[model samples]
Structure formats: C-alpha cells, structure tokens
Target: MYAIERFESRCKKAIESILKRSVELEVPPPEIGALFALPCHGLSKYPEELAGELASKLESLDIDLVGKIEARGAYVNFFPSGEFYEIVLREILQKGDDYGSGEKKDEVIVIDFSSPNVAKPMSVGHLRSTIIGQSLYNILTFLGYKCIGDNHLGDWGTQFGALLAAFELWGNEEELESDPIRHLFELYVKFHRESEKNERLEELAREKFRLLESGSEREKELWKRFVDLSLREFQRIYDLLGVKFDYVLGESFYYSRAKRLVQRALEQGIAKISKGVVVIPLEEFGLPPLVIQKSDETTLYSTRDLATIEYRLEEFSPSKMIYVVGAEQKLYFKQLFAAARKLGFNCNFVHVDFGLVTIGGEKMSTRRGKVVLLEDLLREAIAKAKQVIEERNPLLQNSDEIAKIVGIGAVIFNDLKGDRIQQVDFDLNRMLNFEGDSCPYVQYAYVRGRSILRTAGVTKVTLESVELLSDYEKKLIELLSFFPRIVKLAAETLKPHYIAQYLLDLAESFNSFYTHCRVIGSPNEATRLAIVSATTHVLKSGLSLLNIRAPEMM
Candidate 1:
C-alpha cells in the first residue's frame, strides 16, 4: 500500500511537469490554461492535442502545472504536483488497519448503550443501541483514541421491588426453574393488575422497595438474583451481535454513592430540597426547574445520571462521553447534561440518540406486550438468508455460517443504512433483498472483486512499473484512493452510516469499471492487476470498519 501511494504521488508530480512543458511549447490558442481531469475524454480528434492545448493555455497565463493548473479533454488527463497523495497513501498502507491517528493524546470516548431493562427478553428495539454503539466503538478505535463501552443496565429501583413482591405472592418454583425471566415478567404484569384490586399489596411493594434501598440482607439477595439473571439473558443477545463491553456496570452499580452525590449537590446549594424533593435550578437554562430527587428521598433517573457523571469524571477521567440511547429520552439527556455541567464537570458529555423503531405508527413497547424479540428477528433473517444461499449456491460448504453472517449483517445494516435520527418502520422483506442498497449487494461486489483477483493470480497491486492511462482505470484508482479520508470523516462525526454509504459507492464504482473495461484480458496486465488489488484492499478495509464481514464468495 505504501509503494502504491508513493507511485500515485510521483505520477501526479510528473504529469504536472509534463503539462507545464507541453504548454511552454504549445502551438494553439484553444489550448490556453487547460486543467486536466484524470478520467476525461477527447475534445477535437486527438488525445495529445488536448494535452498540448492545455499546455499552451497554462503557459500563456504563466500559471505553473504544479497543483495550481493542469490540461486535457478527458482520456485520463495529467496534472502537475507536489508529492502529497503519495505521502498520504503511503501513510495509509504503512499504518495498515490503523491509518487515522495523532500523537498528542487525542481523546477518550465513553459510549453507553444497549441498556435493556430487567425481567424482559431483549426486543428488536434494543438492536439500535447495541449495533450503533458497536459501530461507534469500531470507528473510534480506528482513530487514535481510548474508548469506553459501558452498558448502563436497568437494574435498579421500584420496578424490581414490585416484581420481587409479586414473585413472592404468586410463588411458583417450577415455572422459575424452566424460564425465570418470562415467568417473572408474567408475575410482574399480573401484580400491576392485582395491586389495582388490593391497595395493601401495593403498600407491601413500596415497603419492599424501601427495604431494598435500605440494604436489608433479604432484599439485597432478591435484587441480586434479578440482576444476575437479567445480565445472563442480555449477554446471549449481545453475543449474537458480536458486542462486548468494557463495563457491564449499571444503575445499581452507582447506588452506594448515590446518597453522597445528592448530599454534595445539596451542600453546595447546586441542588435544593423543595416540596420534600431535591432539585436543580433551571430557570436560567430556559426550562422548568427539574426534580433531582423525589420527596421520598429515593433517587430518580436524573439523580442516578448526575451521580454517574460525577463518578465517571472522577473515575475514568474521560475526555468525551457518548450516551447512545433512544431519541425518546432526548429531554432527559439534555437535562442530565445541563445539570452535570452546572455541577461544574466540564468534560465532553454527548447524548447520541436515534429515532424510534415503530410498528404501525406507535412506539415499540415491551410493557404494553406489543414487542418483537431481537433473537426472533435474527433467526428469521438467517432463515431467509439460508433460502437465498440455497437458491444462489446450494453446494456451499458452510451454509449455516454464511447465512448467519449475511442474515445478521442484513439486520445490522438495515438499522444503520440511514440517518440515525430518522424513524424506522420495520420491513423484513426490504431488508433481506440482495439486489438493492443492502448488505448482500455490497458482499456480492466484494466477492466479484476477489474473483477477478483470483483469476489474475501471481500479480497484485503494488508500486510496480505500470502506467495508469485508461479513464476507467483512473476512475477506479480515485475511488479506492479516498478510503482513508472517508474513514476519518466517519470516525470524527461518530457516524458509521457515512462509512456504510462509502462502501456502497465503492462497490458501484467497481461494478461500473467492470461493465466498461476489460480487466483479466487487458493488454497492460500489470495496470489491470494493480487496479484489481487496490479495489480488493479498499473493500476489505471499508467493510471491516462497519463491522461487516467480506466473504470471499458470493
């Protein structure tokens, strides 16, 4: 890759010199000040005539052909140069998998995502955070930075206490033995209905919540059981998506220091006790004053969040913290961030929220009993992929593995192929299609590129002796040449969708080049093979950033 880069830069410089020389020795007025576009076509009848024409124009104006000007009417025009492209390309290939980096201790990123609540199967809605967070993690790591992935699990408070009380009242050992989470969920639902009939039962649940908060041994054991079981269930889904976290630390993790946090905010006069609730003044920030604590003195999400921020600032000392949660919690994040800043923690705190995945014009909800499981979706996607595999290539050796990659990749890509803030209407058929802007289309393109390389065996893209004279060849070169830049942009913006779009564009360019040019049978075998190698490398690099696999077979 470094050699490839050096060659490109040298070529640019050489072309610019030739352009200036041609202009200095020009013979026509129509050739004054021509700037060459690498893959342009002829104007009059001759290729060198246009180059000569460009040289004349550049010479007349006394504008040098050194990046400032160039000449030609298409047909792979040439330009003058300094050695910038070569320097950049060499850096990329030499860096190998890590091309974007700096030396001054760039920054630290804390990404909080995939926070499914306790006692519920992970629904497809949770896929947004898990995949989006994973992609962000990949991009940040690609750049020269330290990143922290924290799964802020919902393992806290009254809900668990209610579920616990309900479990005890409707105790069933056999059901718990079979499937604890689902069985607990059923009791949870029933408890709400039953409590509506008996106020005394509701009181017992509140008392239990108090006991859990007060750190009673029995209550502690119950809460621990719920948390442990919930985590194990979440892990299964995470494993399916290839997602891991630096910290499984959750809301409960910060419970011990919560009281101290509230007390400090109170002592500093940053938070006040009013109406028996703790609050942060917000009239100056242009919103209604927020409740930082309830009258009961038990903590709220705001309290836990503010505490988490305080803890993170003290513990990890992060430079940037990203909360990859849903758009529905936009106000909550804004309030939380504002409050944290007010409390005098000036580090970068970002709340990267995405739009909802709705079904029939309503937000997907688990408590409402209208939800789809992520496992189910993955299973379905794979099943459909298995069918496609059979139809496309039945004798494939590892059908299951391939189907899993393609199917799961489709689901991950479907959620990520658009603006993260744009709402999605779930459509299974559209996601599975291999013909459009889907994962399969990109995978097929990579496979096709690989096939070209295989047939052109014994030769690869290098800084070998070859000329890039064809317009199609230049177009392909330019496309692959922009990978490092594109990847850098995506990483800086914390957006994987940009990288996804780039892959689609690269694949399109490959397809177009294939349609217009002869690769394997070309007269200049080295040049054709060079373009082939560059395309393969770029595709592999791009797919890896998006965390998608590039199978060498269609």
Candidate 2:
C-alpha cells in the first residue's frame, strides 16, 4: 500500500471509532467514506450538540501519525506528517517500475476497436479508435484486468456489395493486381457515383452481395482477395503506430454465425419479418427497431454484432465488452445492445463512442475521396519531425529513429489530450510543437530529467539522506503522490485523457522545480535528485500506458 493510502486508512479507522463511541451512530453516512472529508461536516447529519461532541472527540484522539487535528466548528482538518512524504518516496524507489500496478483481477474484458472497413484506406477518422483502444488496453492490463484487444474488422457489409458491383463493371486486372486497396477504393467510390445517376446499379450491387452471401465461388474468391490485400495494407499502419491485437475477427468471421443467431431469434419470437425485412422491435428499451436481415435476406451489421456478443460470452465470458466506435453509431449500438438483451445474452455491453476527426474543419468522407489517409499523415508527420530534429540538434545520432517516436507520439497525444467525445481537428504543427501541451513538450521534460539524473550519477536514493523540503520539492512530491491514483482512475473511467492531462501537469511542475531549485551543487542535492529520478520513471510509465514512446533525448 502507498504511504498516503495507509495514512488515510488509519484516519478512517480512528474517525469511525471516535464516532461510534461518542455519537452513538449505527451507520456512517456516505460523506464520511469520502477521502479527506471533514468529520464534523458529515456528522451534522446528527443533532448539533452530538455533532460537536463527535468533532471534539476526533480532535482529542491519541493518533499522532497525522501530526495535528483541529476542529473548526462543523469541520475537522488533519495534516499529514513529514514522515508521510519520506515513506512515499522510499516506496516509490523500492517499487520502481511496478509502482502503480494493481493486484490481478479475476475478470476478463474484451475491447473491440480500430475496425476500419476492408477496401477503404485507413484515414484520420480511424485514429481515435486505434490509439484510444490501445491506450485503454495498456491501462486495464496495468491495473490487472485480463484484457483482450480485438480488432473487429469491417469486412462484410452493403458497402462491400457496392465495391463488388463497381469492380465487375470497370475494374482492370492489372490495376487491381498492382495496387489492390487503392484500386478497390476507387471502384467503391465510383459505384456510389454511378448508383446516384442510375438506380439500376443499386439493384445490381444488392444482387451481387446476395450472390456473395449465398456462396457463389466467384464472388467468394473476389471477397477473399479484397480481404487479403486490405489486411496487408492495414498492417503497415498498425506497425508504424506500434499497435497489436490479440484477434482480428472481421464481420465475415461472424457472418455464418449470425445466420444461426437470427434463426434462433426468429424461433424464440425475439424477431419477426416486417415488410420482408427481419427486425427486433425495441420500443420498450427506448430504442428504434434493430434490423437483423435486409429484405433481400442479406444480413446487416446488427445481426453480426449480436452474434459477436454471443460469441464473446461463450468464448471468454468477459465481465465487460467495450466497443470503441465513433459517436455517429450511438443509436446503432443502443439498438444492438437492446436486441442482445431481447436475445437473452445478458453481458455488459459498453459503447465507448468518440467524436469524429475532421481534417482542416472538413468532415472526412470516403465516398467523396475527401479524407486524409492515415499512411499519408504519418509519413508527412515523420518527415516534418526529421526536419525539426535537424534544425534543433544537428549532432544528434539516430535522428531518424527519434523522429518516428516524436512524430507518432505527437499525433497520438493530440488525439488523447482532449475529452473523448469532443471533435479532434488534425493540425500536425500544433501537435508537434515543443513549447506547449504536446507530446514533444512532455518528452522534452523527460529528456531534461534524464540528463539531470545522468549528471548526478546517483544510482539509488534512501530516506536517510533526505531532509526538510522547500516549496518546490513539496509541490513535486505532492504531485508525485497522485500518480497511483491517477493510473487507477484512468483505468476505471476508461479515459486516457486523464493520464495525458496528468503528464502535462507533471511536466509543468517539474519545469518549475528545475527553475527554482538547484540539485547537483545544492546542500539537498540527493533529495532533489530523488525527486528528478522518480519524476522521470513516472513520466516514462505514464507515456507507455498511453502507448507513446518517451525518448531519452528529443
């Protein structure tokens, strides 16, 4: 247990004992359970005379670990002793890399994210689900939950039907073989354009999809080719981002299972054919009806999604299944979840929806080919990172490697630094800027701390060498004490932005300490160096949880 946690526990025990003996209260109010709540403030639930007595009793307790306790009318404030800081620092040094890790949890959690559709090039719009999902995986794993990062690929849909129809109409064999994904993407865009003019194209596309679902060998072979080509291209982007998934289950993987699932739903009277389309009416759940199968008998995403929930439950029996999707699909997920309940699979379904990513204030649209491809954005960012490195540190070795780290890290940090539900506008210059609340700024702080540690040559720090702290030291220590809590909070809330904001604050605090305090030549050199050492470890660990690299020097 951390020093602050232990102290808080002791205070709670003391307060409970005091209230039980003096106030004759059988049950403590919820406020009393809050951290650092004024004892007398919650005691006001009782009579005024009794609350005063309880406060007086708390002040007279024989505990000195807190150093002092004062009762100011309807409030009691306790100040932690100096030994608290010493123990916290000692424990941090003792734990080192394992400071914020929690005990193993006996529950499994499945995270489904980064599911870009096959044949569509990954774009800036895909950034949030990919990195956010990876970050949540890191945090939950650190907190000891058995996390399964599943990349649920979008390989089956009406969109693919359109792509197939387009390819058969105008696709060139040499063009497709030379550049499969781009060729397929252009064909998809063309299908939508042509269908807008001639409605017959829409019917043709639906028939092609129906043929594909009915196992036409030709259509199946073409679908496999698209899947193979798209996955290879997607892997390159995943490699550059340093993301990995335990499973890459596409919608096709669940398509056949969805047929059986829909049959079962029909047998159970959970669904019915309405106007030749199968749907589950969910008015009681405050959601619109969920379409399971189209009028042409081709399955929809809802059918596959329910199958996904069923498969995950029977396979992993996860305590929770999180879908990291865009905010536009909020209603779709609600309908899916409600349909799942109707189907009698009662698993925890969470939709972690995030706002859309716009490029220069324009919403990305693949149908119009107006989206910025993720591969292009990454390459441009890395090139710009190389240019900045050359200008800042001409003598730096392995600058290429460092630029990738900084550039990619900046893009990821920008995505995570704001609220998940807020729209993210891409601006590489702002993200890579080293002077503000960007990844480079935080990385630079880490580099500076590392330089200080290397110069000090202090391999270890002990409580014996530490003494009284100045305001700067005290501020840093107080901030450091919150690291463990911050990590746990990020895990619980499923928000990586909390960790991002915390790192920015820590970097700002460390910079302040560096400016106002002397370390190497000061009389409290060992003490200040300890602070620097701990800060670096935390900065590195926090960045790692966000799936960002912390370079030694940037």
Candidate 3:
C-alpha cells in the first residue's frame, strides 16, 4: 500500500474506533466519514465545530503512521512525519516502474472500441474511441483487472450493400487495387449521389445486401475481399497509434448468431414484426423502439450487438462490458442495454460515450468527404514536429524518430487532457505547444530530470542521504505520494483525464522544485537527485498508461 492510502486507512479506523468508545455524546459514525485523511486540505470543507470535535476526539489516540492532527478555524490539517516521507520515497525508488500497479484480479473486462466501418477511412472522429479505449486498457491492466480489447469492426449491414452496388456500377479494379480506401469511399459517395436521383438503385442495393447475407458465393467473396483490404489499411493506422486488440470480431462474425437470436425472440414473443421489420418495443422503458432486423430480413447493428453480448457472456463471462462509442449513439446503446436486460443478461453494461470531434464546428461525413483522414492528420503532426525540432536543436541525432514520438504524443495528449464528454476542436497548434498543457511539456519535464541524473552519473538513487530537506522538497514528496491514489481513482472513474491532470500538476510541481532547489552542487544534491529520479519514473509510467511514449530527450 502507498503511504497516503495507508494514512487514510489508519485515519478511518482510528476515527471509527474513537466513535465507538464515546459515551456522553451519541455521535453517529456516518457524520465522521468526511473527516478521514485530515490532510492540510481535507477538512476545510467541513464545519469548524465538526472539525474541532473530530480533532478533540482523536488527539489522544496513538496512531503509528500519523504524525499530528489539529484544527485551525474552519480548516483542520494533518502533518505527515518524516516516517511517511521515508516510506513514500523508498517505495517509489524500490518499485521503480511498478510503483502504481496493483495485485491480480480474477474478473475480466471486455472493452469494445475503434469500430470504424469497413471500406471507409478513419477520420478525426475515430480518434477518441481508439485512444480512450487503449488508455482504459492500460489503466485497468495496471490495476490488475483482466482486460480484453475488442475492435468490433462494422463489416456488415445495408451500407455494405450500397458500397457493393456502387462498386459494380463504376469501380475500376486497377484503381481499387492501388488506393483501396479512397476508391471505395468514392464508390460509396457515388452510390448515395446516384441513389438520390435513381430510386432503382435502392432496390439494387437491398438485393445485393440480401445476396451477401444469403451466402451467394460471388457476393461473399467480394465482401471478404473488402474486409481483408480494409483490415490491412486499419492495421497501418493502429501500428502508428500503438493500438492492439485481442479480438477483431466484426458484425459479420455475429450475423448467423444474430439471425438465430432474432428467430428465438420472435418465437418467444419478445420481438414482433411491424411494417415487415422486426423490432423490440421499448416504449415502456421510455425509449424508442429498437429495430433488430430490416423489412427484408437483413440484420441490423442492434441484433449483432445483442448477439455479441451473448457471445461474450458464454465465452469470457466478463464481469463488465464497456463500449467506447460516440455520444451520438447514446439512445441506441441505452435501448440495446435495456433490451439485453429484458432478455436476462446478467453482466454489467457501460457505454463510455464521448462528444464528437468537429472541424470548424461541423461533424465529419464520409458521403460528403468533409472529414480529415487520421493518417493525414498524424503525418501532418509529424511534419510540424520535425520542423520545430530542427529549429530548436539543429544537430540532434535521430530527430526523425524523436519527431514521431512528440508529434503522436501531442495529438493523443490533446484528446485526453480534458473531460471525455467535452467536444475537441481539432487544433494541432495547441496540441504541439511545448510550453502548454500538452504531452510534450510533460515529456520534456521527464527529459530534463533524466538529463540531470545522467550529468550526476547516478545510475541508482537512494534516500539514505536525504537529510535537511527544504519546503520545496517536502512539497514535491507530498505530490509524489498521491500518484498511487491518482491511478486508482482514474481506474475507478474510467477517466484518463484524472491521470492527465495529475501529471500536469506533477510536472509543474517538479519544475518549481527544480527552479528553487539546486541539485548539481548543493549540500542536498543526493536528496534532490532522488526527487528527480522518482519524478521521471512517475512521468514515464503515467504517460505509458495513456499509451503515449516518453522520449529520453526532447
């Protein structure tokens, strides 16, 4: 356990024990819940009388780890003694990269994210799901939960019928073989355009989809080709983004199961046909009716999603299944979860919805080709980073490699530096600003600390000669003590912003300490160097949790 957590736990126990021993005052224990951790800022929110009462109650008790507790006006503070600092610093230095990780957990969690439709380029819109899901995976895994990343690809449905129809009408084999996604996207756009004028195209598309669903050899082969080529394309982006999934189960993978499920639902009277389309009415649940199958018996995403839930339950029996999807589908997921509950699914379902990414206040659309391709955005960031690097450090070795790390890290940090539900206006300048609350700033802090340690020729750090500490050193240690708690909070809340904001605060704090405390030739050089080393480890570990690389140099 971390020093801060240990302190809080002991404080809670002490407070509870004190309440149990009280006779004259019938003080309820629930009122004292907020009084634990009595740190400098812990009791400021409580009433002065309550603070004093708690202080008087526990001032006599002998707590080993706690140093002193006192109430001042409406604010009460607890000062951790030298023993707490010793334990916190020693644990950080001893554990190194494993400082914040937890014990193993038996429960499994499946995260479904980054599920872009096949044959369409990944846009800025897909960035949130991909990175957010990856960060959650890292955090949950670090906290000892068995996490499964499932990239539930959108490879089946009526849209594919339109794509196939478009391809048969105007697609060139050579163009498709050369630039698969672009050509496929053009074909898709053309289909929507022509269908606006030619109603016959709609029937043609439905027929093509029916054929594909019914297992026509040629249709299946074409669809398989599309899926294969799309996967190769998606892998390139995933490689650049450092994203990997344990399962790449597409909608097609669950089609047969979905069909069987719909049949069972119909026979059991859980679903009914209206206007020749199968649906589960959720009006009683205060949601619109959920369509599981179209009029032509083509399975919809809802059908496949329910089938997916069933498959996960029977296969992994996960304790929780989280979907990292856009907020636009908020209602749809609620309906899906409600339908699943009605069908008696026992697992927990969570929709980790995020706001949309917009360019000039406009949501991206494939049909209009108004979206920025993720590859284009990433490559542009790299180029911008390279330009900045050359200007800053002309003779830096492996500048290209370093640029990739900084560029990609900046983009990711920009997305995660705020609340997940807040809309991000795609801005590369803000993301790449080295002095701002960007990833590069935090990365540079690590690089600066590493440089200090290298100059000191300190391959190993110890807290033995850490006597005569300054206020700055103590403040830095206090901030460092909160890292494990921050990690646990981020994991519990399913919010990476907690860690991001914490890292920013930590980096800022370290910078302040570095400015105030001299390390190279100071009397407390060993102590300050230990502080630098611990800060670098935490910065690196926290960045890894967000799936961003921390370069040794900037």
Candidate 4:
C-alpha cells in the first residue's frame, strides 16, 4: 500500500512534467525503457542489446535518462542507479515476507475441492487436487482473500444402502475396529455381488434407503453411524496429506434444503414437468432440458449442488466460487452453473478442471485397483531421495531431514512446474532425479545463494554509489523485481505454474550469476552481497508459495 501511494505520487509528477514539456517544446516525449533481458539478438547477448538499442535511441532524442537499458541477444535489461537500489531493496528488506503481499480486495472465495468420498482411499489422482487446491488456497490467502475450503464429501446415495446391507450380512465387529474403510470396501464388494441373487435383501436395502429419506430414527442413527465410521477413516488420510477443510459437510447435509430448493424452482417456473420427471427447461440455452427431480423423487448431484450453491452464497457471500474437480465433471459443472444462473445467482462462478493423474499411460482408479496411494508414491519418492542424498554425499549430515525436504518437495514441485491442464505421467525416475529441472536442483540453487552470502559474512546490505551493474547482476536484479508482478499475475490467472516457472528462471539466472561473479572477499562485496541476499529471499519466497520446503544447508 505504501509502495502504491509512493509510486502513484511519483509517477503522476513524472507524467505531468513530461506532458507539460511535450506541449511546450512541440515534440513527442521519449519512449520509456521498461523491459529487461539478456542480449541474444543479432549476435549480441540479451543485456547488451537491451542497453545498446535503447541507449542509442534515447541519446539520439537527447533525453537525460535516470537509468540504462541494455540487452544480451534476445534479452533486454535495465539497471537503475543507487537511488533506485536503495529505495527498492530497503522496501523489500523492511517488508520481509510481506514484501510482495499487496493488500488485495477482501473478497470471499469458496473453494470446493478434493471432494473425496467416505471410505475411499486417496489415489495419485487425488494428489493433483490436493496440491493444486492447497497451493491455490495459499496464493489467494496471501493475496488477502477470505477463502473457504469446502470438502463436499460424497456420503449420500444408493452406494450407502448397498454398503449397509452388506455390512449387516457380512459385517465383522473386530475388523471394523482395526481398519474401517477396508472393511466397508469388502462389504460393499460382496453386497454388490449378492444384490442380484436375493430380492429380499435388495428390498431391505430399498426400504432402508426410503426410511433414511423419510427420516426414521433408526435410519438416521444408522446413517450417522456409517458417516462417523467413514469420517474416522477419511480423517487419517487427510491428515497424512496435510489437507484441512473449513467444512466437511456431506451430500446428505443438503437433502432437506434440496427438497425446498426444488419446490422453489417449481414455484418460480424454473422447474417444469418433462418426460414425467421435474426438469429445468433449458433447451433454448444450447443444452437439453435437465432433470431437476426424477419421477422417483430421488435427488441427483445437480440438485444437491443447486442447494449447495444457494447455501454457500447465503452463508459466506462469496465474491467468487471455484470448484476444483476432475475434467469428467465438465458437463456437470456447466449444468450447475447454467441452472444457478437460470435461478438468478449473481456471483461469479468458476470450475477449475484438470486432466487425470496417470502413471505409465494408464488411468488410475479404485475399481481396477490400479490406483497408487498418495502415501505410497510419496514414500517411494522419499526413499529414492535418500538414496540420491547418500550416493551424492556419503557424509551428508541429517540425511533424513534433507531427504524429506527434497523428497516431498519433488512430488509437489514436479506437479506444479507445469500448467495444471497438462497431464502428468507420474514418472518416478524424472521426479527423483537430482539433476536437470528437478526440485532438488532449484533448492540447490538457493543453497548456493545462501552459501555465497554466508561466505561473504553478509551481515548487512548497503547501497553504494551505484552505476550500471554488469549484465549478470543487473539481469538477475531485474528478475528479482519481477516477483511482485508475477505474484499478481498468478493470482489473477488462477495459475500457480506461472510462479513456479518464474522461480526456476530466477534459480537458473542465479546459478549463472554465481558462476560468473564471486561474492566473498570481492572488491565489490556490498553489491554482490545485496545480489546474494535478494536471490536467497526470492528463492525462499517462491518455494514457500508452492508449499515446498527449502533447506538452507542443502
């Protein structure tokens, strides 16, 4: 906020002066040099081209400049004077972690994500939402938005009735105590198979379902027991994955509300009788009419979602609601949004859909049992990381700690490095590598920056009578200046991969700067120390945004 006010005042005065002079002198104002890059154009490095081209143009125009614009080949560059350095660096150092955190609007956002069903194991596919949603939460919260994480648990449906029938017939009292989800899984498998052979058992399940809907005391108690038991199992997996939801309200939670919601739709003429089922007449809106209520009177996901939508708006008054679900539900979300709009929802809605998380070109699902547990994948990554740490440095101290920082980081960062739309093949070999575009490599770059700073005994960063810094340092600083802008872009675009890629670029640039410039015992120790500190801060901030840990000692 302070930066905004300060920049506003300065920019206004500068532009006003330029305008006044332009009219007085009857000449156009000189173009401002704003971009920075390394020279790589016309056989020159990006930094050289940036400086030469802009410097020549401005000199020709006879405009007294405050800074130099240079380039190296394809890269354009900028170097501000000592005054600029003092102002920018002091602001960043003063703000610390709050350096880039602009006070964004106090908007409420309902993030419906990772809506895993009860008694279901979290697979690698779930890991996509787990990481994506968590990172999005961090980014939005960092931007000062009030975010509500909603876990729309799949707890109501025909599946529960089948599960109950199976539990009653083949339920073991002891295995439920040891492992409830697995026990339910077994019962569910058996009940599904036996439902075809026995009509009495099937009728009993149907009666129980009816009793559940009709709010019988025994049915309520049974449903509560099943939900509690399932939740007990779900929480363990959620805890392991570091996911916490503000609300874990299930599908059943809105059954009562759904009944009222459908009735209102009927009263409002949004619901119509079609094919003997209550349907929303949306044929004019490029889609067929949707069944709002079935002839049997059982509600669907769309019905519960409509109620959920109305409830969320009433409860949180969110400015935006984003659902991070699988791509297969694209049509479902479209219908929900359309129905909500048709029913007069004024809030902005978004569905963040992502491709499946597959391994070795095969779909991962529970039915096929081809799914990889997130825990198992993480453990394997950690194990491989441990091996890498040992092989790289036999005397590496605190191997377990380093392994974790790198291992878990690899899993998270690997997925984050690409756009969320990109389908990940979940290659273990690629994820665990210490070289070539891996998470550990980026962390190593940070450790290198820290190492350099430590060697220089960097107790303080002082602004010297600065001139045009060399290509590497100036280009690197230009990259550092991109942090705030990139943060804004990431939040606006609803894409964390933007920040991820920017961090990698900064790391790669820092490596080049390190190879070229020596900070410790240098004649220009202050300048180099400033660069090292900036690099370390940027890497730290970037890694933290992705929920990845950075090891100072690595």
Q: What TM-score would every model get versus the actual structure?
A: 0.83, 0.92, 0.94, 0.83
The TM-score of candidate 1 is 0.83
lDDT of 2 by residue, 274-305 (tens): 99999999989987799999988889988998
Name the TM-score of candidate 3. 0.94
Stretches of model 1 off by over 4 angstroms after superposition: 1-106, 192-204, 458-460
In order, the Cα lDDT scores of the candidates are 0.72, 0.84, 0.86, 0.72
Candidate 1 lDDT over residue span 1-554, tens digit each: 33233334544555466554322122123133212334323234566566566555544443332344445443333333334333433444445445443333557778888888887788878888889998888777766578888888888877777887988889687887688788877787788778778988877887787788888899889678777888888887777777889988878888867778889988999888788888888877776666876666777767777778888888888998999998888877777878888889887888888989877768876545677778888889989999998899978888888898888888888888888999888777877777779988888888887888788674334544445445565555555655665666776777788888878887888888888878777776666665656666677777776767778775
The true-versus-predicted C-alpha distance at residue 87 of model 1, in Å, is 7.4
Off by over 4 Å in 2: 15-59, 62-65, 68-78, 459-463
Best by TM-score: 3
Candidate 2, residue 514: Cα displacement in angstroms equals 1.3
Candidate 3 stretches with Cα past 4 Å from truth are 20-46
In model 2, the Cα lDDT at residue 382 comes to 86
User: What ranking emerges by TM-score with the best candidate at the front?
Assistant: 3, 2, 1, 4
In angstroms, give how far residue 204 of model 2 lies from its true place. Answer: 1.2
Q: In candidate 3, what are the lDDT values of residues 180-212, reduced to their tens digit? A: 999998889888888899999999999999999
Give the top-scoring candidate (lDDT).
Answer: 3
Of the two candidates 1 and 3, the one with more favorable lDDT, higher being better, is: 3
